[model samples]
Target: MRADVAFVNGAIWTGDPGRPWARSLCVTYGRVAALDDDRECAAAHETVDLGGRTVVPGFNDAHHHLALRGRRLATLDVGHAAAPTRDRLLGLVAHKARELAPDEWVRGGGFDQNRIGGFPTREELDAAGGGRPVLLSHVSEHIAVASTAALRAAGIADLRRPPDIPGGRIVLGADGAATGLLLENAKKWFDATLKPHRIDELVGFLDTASRTALAEGITSITDPGVGGLDGIGMGRADLHGYLTARERGSLGVRVTAMPYITTTHALAGLEPGVDGWGLDLGLRTGFGDEFLRLGAVKVLSDGSLIGRTSALHEPYCAHAPGEEPGRGMLAFDPERLAETLGLLHRSGWQLAVHAIGDRAVDLAVGHVEEAQRRHPRHDARHRIEHCGIASPEAVQRIARAGIVPVPQGRFLWELGDGFLDALGEQRSRSVYRMKSFLDAGVVLPGSSDTPVVDAHPMKGIHAMVNRRTAQGRLIGPQERLTVEQAVRAYTHGSAYAAGEEGIKGRIVPGLLADLAVLDADPFAVDPRDLADIAVVATVVGGRVVHGADALA
Candidate 1:
């Protein structure tokens, strides 16, 4: 039988356990039809000579922020790469201020106080903003700093008398004035000014983000939050934004968008007396087809680890000068979290809780266990997002619950130094555990949490194998995973996290025709040089989505 496309003369890592390698494959009607010698010289409408390059299943990022990444791409970047010093960050703000109108807002993101020396004060932002409102987001996106003008734009009339916000913090300075720092839910105040007002605007952001994903050979991504109430998502129209993106042919990668759910507050369109909260008309997880499908309901249980806001059992190793010393704060009361988890689980929604600290992980684990016990669903596939500081006991419990731990290996290289500073030498070993999760029989999905760091999967893979920090110090030597295991985490493991392992991930016949051709073999390269390996071509459904000109 003839095929629509044939890929020949390559080292193909199929990612299937039964047939791990193939030299050639044929695709028919957007699905793999033949593999190995069976497809040699098969007649096809189109042929892609891999030119003896190494090909693997396209990368699948289980936890990413496509909307946020796209928005950041359009904004001024004060990140470590763009602005390594405090002066440089302020310079970028000044440059942005000059480019914007006097009344227009100046938006920027991806700044880390640790790397940039210290957080920008309202006074500094005021000077750089030049009468325009300025807003700069932290690398974690859990915290943000606003200029004095921006504070007024958010209705904060008096800096000394900021409004009380639940599940968030408005940090104050020594003089009892707002320090311009907003944490967790407190960032919601600026939603009106920062959030995209139109569905088309959000769709534009998706288009920009998808281009970046395709260039990196990312075929699928599970966005952790959308339509979230805490101002984290693009509001209620976020689902429509994805649909519009797909319809317009702008969304290049398959997406599994999770609705951010909170039981503490009433959702706008929820049916009265319903068992739980979700989209209207009983639309919950698994509602849409491939390319743009609903996955889990995301519930943030705590803040970020690097920001020192994630709820932890023990106090942090160190705190910024003049800052209060504590274990950090939880996003919700324990009882409220339990209630939310139970309601969602009973209503048949897959849960993905953002739990970073050990305390938060244990809290999520207990609640998920109770939820499943009260309403037994063997295939619920609940997840712990981040799980950054899981204890050994927590790891065992995560395995027992069969919960997927979606952690970013890229964090090892980009934020591991900060993690080391916060957790100290002792507890740092458990940070972003990879080998531990695999050894415990738990699936460890790979992710980048893009806009938080670089979204390149090869960088994540390198971090997983090397376990080194930006400063070249090893934080979790024992937690390092092998190169092969890291690849699986990015492919099959991430696919399993979204309940699509049977359809994609592996390049065996009958699966989706998605693959990435690399200029050099990742398995053959030195672990240190793995991040340098670049994708020469990316194929999705037998179509070359990127690097077609480079394809031989």
Candidate 2:
């Protein structure tokens, strides 16, 4: 049979071990038809010369929040790049508030109170908001700052004192007044009374996100919180967004979703109908087709390291006088987590729990172990997202349980400075234990955890090989991986994490034709310049999705 497309004259680093490298590839009907020297490719209808560029399997972000990222693109970006200082952040919010009518909400994110020195206050937000309800999320997403108007709107306006609850926090000032800081589940307060986005709005967000992912050469991504809708407007879920995007042909890349658990500890159904978002019928993980599918059930066991809320085994090092040293915080009653895991696992749903701190890691490990012991599923490839601050023993234990530790390689480059300042050198260097996970027989998958950081796979690769922070300081020299290992983690390892290794992640015959062409070879580039290597072209399903016009 004649090939549909012949990608010729390129240096391809096929992820498949048998055909590790190839000079050309052939694709027919969206599947890889040949590795090299396929005579049928000569009769192909289309022939594109790759100009001898370096090619690798397309990137797969094993864990990401594309919907949220898409929405953030339209929100006020107070990220380090946009508003680097406290004054600039408030100025942006105030400027945006001037454009809106009174009582309108000023919603935005990417403000790092750590970089701003401390949590922002309502007084500051009020100065720019003009009676508007302002809600600004931290860079970590685990924390947020709500203005007085927002607080009053949420029915917690009196600052002299605050309501206390389990698994959440409300930061208070010296006089016991609310400081506009909300942590963990308390961040939900600012989300009250907002209307959920229409299905069309969701489709727009998905399109924006998919375009960005394609430009970055990411062919696949798994959303960690699909149906949870914890922070969606209107307290309702946009569960139909994925299906709508797919139906409209706007979902440019493959997507896998893990339905997040609700406060009732019940899972959302596979389909959304008239009755609430929860289906209760019969749909576990591993549902759906190739473009849109179900992945593991996602659960966030603890907060984030940057937010200083990931339940840790020890006290945090960064602190001032009259302040709580603050280790971290964990969620879900143990019984609740175990019971939920038991039900999901027994129903054949794979699990993906977010565990950032060592303590949270222990809880995740124990729960998985207990659940597996109670009802064993031999090939269940449950995963722990972030696996952020694991110890040596924890890595070994995770490996023994056959759990893939999906880590964002970009964290070291982006958040390494804060990590070092808060945890000291020894502890900070040990976080994300990439090499150790591999050494301990674990499949250490790589991802971007985007919206929290840049989603560029090359940036993540740079972090993997250099272990350098944003300030150019090296944190953990010992954990540095070679280019091949780093690339595999982002490609094959990520596919394995999503249980799609059989279909994607490789350039072998019969696999899908998803590949990325880089301007320079990673192995030949300087370690620091790894991220500088541009994606010249990106191909998915044997068709070029990005930079195709540039190809000859």
Candidate 3:
């Protein structure tokens, strides 16, 4: 049969050892035609030589934030510097201030209190910003540091809480004045009031993020939450943005968007199995031509770990005496969460709940299990996002419930020190326990949670295998997984979580042709050197999205 393109002279790891390696693959109409030999390719219409490079299935990031990633690129970056001190952060602010007009806001991201020693105050930010409104996000995206002008611009001159939202705190000084720190949803006040980006500009942002993900060997990503009354504004705008980018031939990676639960109310008016539900807008959890789709229903159960706002069973170790144990905030009351899950589960919509602390995880898992039992649906494939600080009991319950734990392995690499400090030794030791989850018979999918950390699968793999902190301390030596196990969690495990394992995870006949080419075999290298492996190329549906060079 005539083929559109064929890649030969390559070492392919198809994720299935039974048919582990292939010498060549044929492509037609943007799908895998066949895995064949040179003789088979000679019969094809076109052929290219790979020069014996290593090829594996394309990396699938189970968790990521596409819009935030693009915003980071255009904003000031304080997270890249090796040990960002006060002076270095100020330097970044000053540099950004010079580039913007006097009144324009200077937005920056990737600032961490752990790295910078402490949060920047309004006075400090004002000095660095040179009279412009400056707003810098914490590395976790759960907190922010804003100059006095920016706070004032958001109409937060005096410390006042919004009527309904709880668990969001605005740090105040001893003099009863507002500090620059905005925790949890309080950051949204400024984020929402900021100037909106044009549709063309937003599309450009998504294009840049997609190209970056492709270059890093990422072929697919699940954006957990988008759009709502919450400041993100991802609903119709994000839909149009992805559609525009795909039409312009600028999007190279597959995106599965999980719209926020607040938008679920809007979908209530629409009938189930509605044809072209966001499909014309380029959406479908299990649809599309594989480039973009809607994946799952995203719900937030609590706040963030770093912000000391995640709902937990025990008091935060860092909480001051007499302060309310710092038990954190719950995004939805138990009844509300259970009701939401019941509705989504009955509708056959897969759910991914963001539950960070052990208590929140337990609550979410229980709700899902109860929903499944009462509603009794098959192949629902519900997931607990973060699952970061679950106890052994919670882990067993999660496993028993048949829910997937989509943990961010990159957090171990970026926030290990802070985790240890806040959660103490015992709880911190179990953080990001990939092996424990697997051993308990729970499906564990690896993710980057990009914008929170660098979304490189290699780095995530290194953290999974090494489980070490930036200071080189072994945070959880017992929680480490082998190289092979880590790879499966990122690829096959993630596919399973998305209910696409049969068609996309393993490279075999009838599977999608999503693959990555590497400079070196990850299995052949020393465990400690896994992070050093370079991505030579990334191919999705037989198309070469990125490469070290064109095939010979």
Candidate 4:
């Protein structure tokens, strides 16, 4: 009756209310078999001495972009650390241009105009590219700038007369010439430059992302978008890439991929009579097994808040020169959005609508409510991704509809200044509200939206508890969460959002044997030092996936 593997001499945060802590844990066949102080519990074929370290359930990032993060890791370095100034950013682009062939695109990402002083001008990029096309994505990934060469390469015959794009912007200068700043869906026009990755290339990206997640003690992730919709995902073959990665044993962490809603059209299997709004027959939400599964249909209902494109009720505090002031834009018209949500809901697919601004949130809330009224389904667990700015009334509606609000706490640390500038002081306080959602009796899942920021769960936990911006400014101090509450958000809260709470979130008996052993206890450390704590070892299903060398 001995366990298969045992961890001894450790402090385990079980995440279960009744039994909150344990001194030792035993795993049998990849499920937590027992948690006891008895030395007998340590009698297993293989027992690891934890050396009194602290253990918690492995983190589950509810809104990460796996393959995209890996791709960014391999791209040009222009983030705050890599290029902190305008000169550094342009210098990096220039250097990349020199290394590439004259015809190749000089690509870069993760540059923040807020920190790097300002967005690089199209003319400035033209010089850096030296006639080579260049495209540098803002850290938010919602906006990007392309060199003049790139516009021509993309077949734009007239810079001043670019095709009219709804739900996107092609910035025009005072002279009425294109400014090269592409916002929201406008980036899709340069698909030739941003080519879709091959299945093998996608698997490679997944491999890189998996290693990074394991190192961060993240055992499960819900990638918000895949299947190349609106130029956000990898490609149409993205699901195949994930499956190949899993079959090849390259993906070490569990993934619940939310395929783009429109991707269903491009996919095979459309019955002549049946609606084509969902996956093939018998494949809906919760389709696959533990390693890889379909979670929800990702619908990009609005743009990025930091990018100043999210639909808002009030005008933005700041504006670009020569630009008229206005509230942000929605990706879909209200009628179109309602129709889409209704179709998906009736088809038994959970909807993860990305609504950032209060204006967009209102539409999303109303859509979900109306969908349920028309065709009610219990425990549907529809999610509102990045419900960034929810008023008290909106929060109440969210709770009443049993919607999960997936907000990234790391945004406070990475994009807080941009948010402050965009929404001003009063409205900024309501952005990314954590405590208020909890107060309204709603589950708030923690996420990083990585590649936009750091993916470490500790960074998210620290940001949630501190609410401090990168400039040392604190916003919404009253909305700050306790350290324990923050930790739970990354653990049980995220698992609950993905409907995996019964299996993986807690370290209780019969739950998956997934744990993250840390060098220091998050509960015992200073709130400011949460991000500094290192993961000593990471275990997935009783097998050490990261830091095995240190444990050995």
Give the per-residue lDDT digits (tens) of candidate 4, residues 178-277. 9889888787555534667888888888999999999999999999888864657888788899999998988989999998876764223345555546
Stretches off by above 4 angstroms in model 3 are 80-83, 157-164, 229-236, 266-287, 319-325, 548-550
Q: By TM-score, is 3 or 4 better?
A: 4
For model 3, state the Cα shift of residue 215 in Å.
0.9
Model 1 agreement with the true structure over 3-120: per-residue lDDT tens digits: 8889998999999888899899999988899897454346787888899999999999999999989999988988998999999999999998998889898899999887877799
lDDT of each: 0.88, 0.83, 0.79, 0.87
- By lDDT, rank the candidates, best first: 1, 4, 2, 3
Better of 2 and 4 by lDDT: 4
Clashes of each: 0, 1, 3, 0
Model 3: per-residue lDDT, tens digit, 359-459? 89889989998888888877678899998788888888888788899998878878888788778888888777688899998767879988889899999
lDDT of 2 at 185: 78
Model 4 poorest ten-residue lDDT run: 265-274
User: Model 1 Cα displacement at 390 (Å)?
Assistant: 0.6
Q: What is the lDDT of candidate 2?
A: 0.83
Clash count, predicted structure 4:
0
